[model samples]
Target: MDKITYDGIRNFIIENELTDSVAISLHPDSFDELVMDYLDINNNQIERPFEILGIEILQDSTGSVQKNKVNILNVV
Candidate 1:
């Protein structure tokens, strides 16, 4: 799996024009865990965003499930 760092993730969202795309991870996987882990490792802390949008992650097939591969749908 690719190492998605804080800057990498922030850049990815910016590049994708997803200022509102982040907030929460839809899936209960290591991606979110990794983010938290990274933050913990880096000793970084962040407050919740104005709108911490929730998501519904659609898991993929192949019997090889991953959190980062989740297809996120905004929570209405």
Candidate 2:
């Protein structure tokens, strides 16, 4: 992600007081292992549903940052 997007997300998390619930994983299998690992590592036993926004940013031929895929995962 670019600096602007990163900063915006960071600010949103901080302002909403969701620092403990959000995690960023850059690996290919981020959704499969990283999310689970984060939950286990943090011992987060959240009873309610939480959302994970998976953003895939890529550069087009013109070298502009483009958002390719956005997947919203609701984990209960």
Which candidate's lDDT is highest?
A: 1
Please give, for residues 1-76, the per-residue lDDT of candidate 2 as tens digits.
Answer: 2322333443544555553333333323333333455467458652223333333222223323224222222223
Tens-digit per-residue lDDT, 44-72, candidate 1: 76344312222222323444555554333
**Stretches of candidate 1 exceeding 4 Å from the true structure:** 21-29, 36-44, 48-70
User: Deviation in angstroms for 18 in model 1?
Assistant: 1.2
Write down the TM-score of every candidate.
Answer: 0.43, 0.25
Give the Å error, residue 45, model 1. Answer: 2.4
The segments of candidate 2 whose C-alpha lies over 4 angstroms from its true place after superposition are 1-4, 22-76
The top-ranked prediction according to TM-score is 1
For candidate 2, what's the RMSD? 10.2
Cα lDDT, all candidates = 0.43, 0.35
